[model samples]
Target: MSGGVVTRGRERRDQQNGQNSKTTEQKRDEEQVQLAEANSLALTMRSGLQAISKEIRDLKTEMKKDLTTLKEQVTEDVKSEINDLK
Candidate 1:
């Protein structure tokens, strides 16, 4: 009877260990999937940010060109007005 009990106890412990190993493996797989998704999202966001940065740069260039044109026009108008007053 004593030998039988010891064998049964070992069997139960082995079963529990197997179950724990399976659970750990499942958790590792889930973590890997989540990490992959997070990396993909980060890459997508970086691409969007790059596009936005380019658009902002283009807008700045256009605004500078417009300001330069306006300054030249204003200078010409002022010169014309002074000559007419004289």
Candidate 2:
């Protein structure tokens, strides 16, 4: 009877160990998937930021051109008004 009890206890312990190992494997797989998704999201965000930076640079260039044109127009108007006064 004692031998039978020992054998049963060992069997139960083996079963529990197997269950724990399976759980650990499942958790590892889930972590890997999450890591991959995070990496993909980071890459997508970087690309979007790069695109925004380019757009901002283009806008700056356009604004500079508009300001130069306005300055030239103002200077010509001022000169015209002075000549009329003279």
Candidate 3:
């Protein structure tokens, strides 16, 4: 309700808790603050995820390079053994 609907049944309850209720302006301000905080947290999380994803990609590339190097080294060793046998 806009300011709080006052029904006969709720009259007493309203009277008692009226002071505890927030004004619409106060509620709006609080909601805006909460939204801003949520947006900030979402941005932070997104950036964190991006950083992790980049790290993973870099690691994969490095791993592939290392594996290729190891394979080449093994091939060279095998060729050297064949030459020795001949």
Candidate 4:
């Protein structure tokens, strides 16, 4: 009877260990999936940021050109007024 009890206990422990191993594997797989999703999101965000940066640069260039033209026009107008005064 003592030997039978010991054997049965060991069998139960082995079964429990197997179940625990399966649970741990599932958790690992879930973590990998989440990691992949996070990586994908990060890549997408980087791409979007790059696009925004390009757009901002283009806008700055256009604004600089407009400012230059306006400055030239103002300078010419001021010169004309000065000539009239003279």
Over 1-86, each residue of candidate 3 has an lDDT whose tens digit, in order, gives 54465565488778657755657667888999999999999999999999999999999999999999999999999999999999
Candidate 4's C-alpha runs over 4 A off are none
Q: What are the models' TM-scores?
A: 0.85, 0.85, 0.66, 0.85
Per-candidate count of clashing residue pairs (backbone under 3 Å): 0, 0, 0, 0
In model 2, where do residues sit more than 4 Å from their true spots? Answer: none
lDDT of 1 by residue, 1-86 (tens): 99999999999999999999999999999999999999999999999999999999999999999999999999999999999999
Could you give candidate 2's per-residue lDDT for residues 1-86 as a string of tens digits? 99999999999999999999999999999999999999999999999999999999999999999999999999999999999999
Q: After superposition, how far is residue 81 of candidate 2 from its true place, in Å?
A: 1.7
Which of candidates 1 and 3 is the stronger one according to lDDT? 1
Indicate the residue-level lDDT of 32 in model 3.
100
Q: What lDDT is reached at residue 83 by model 1?
A: 100
Tell me the lDDT of candidate 3.
0.89
- Each model's lDDT comes to 1.00, 0.99, 0.89, 0.99
Measured by C-alpha RMSD in angstroms, how accurate is candidate 2?
A: 1.4
* Model 1 superposed RMSD (Cα): 1.4
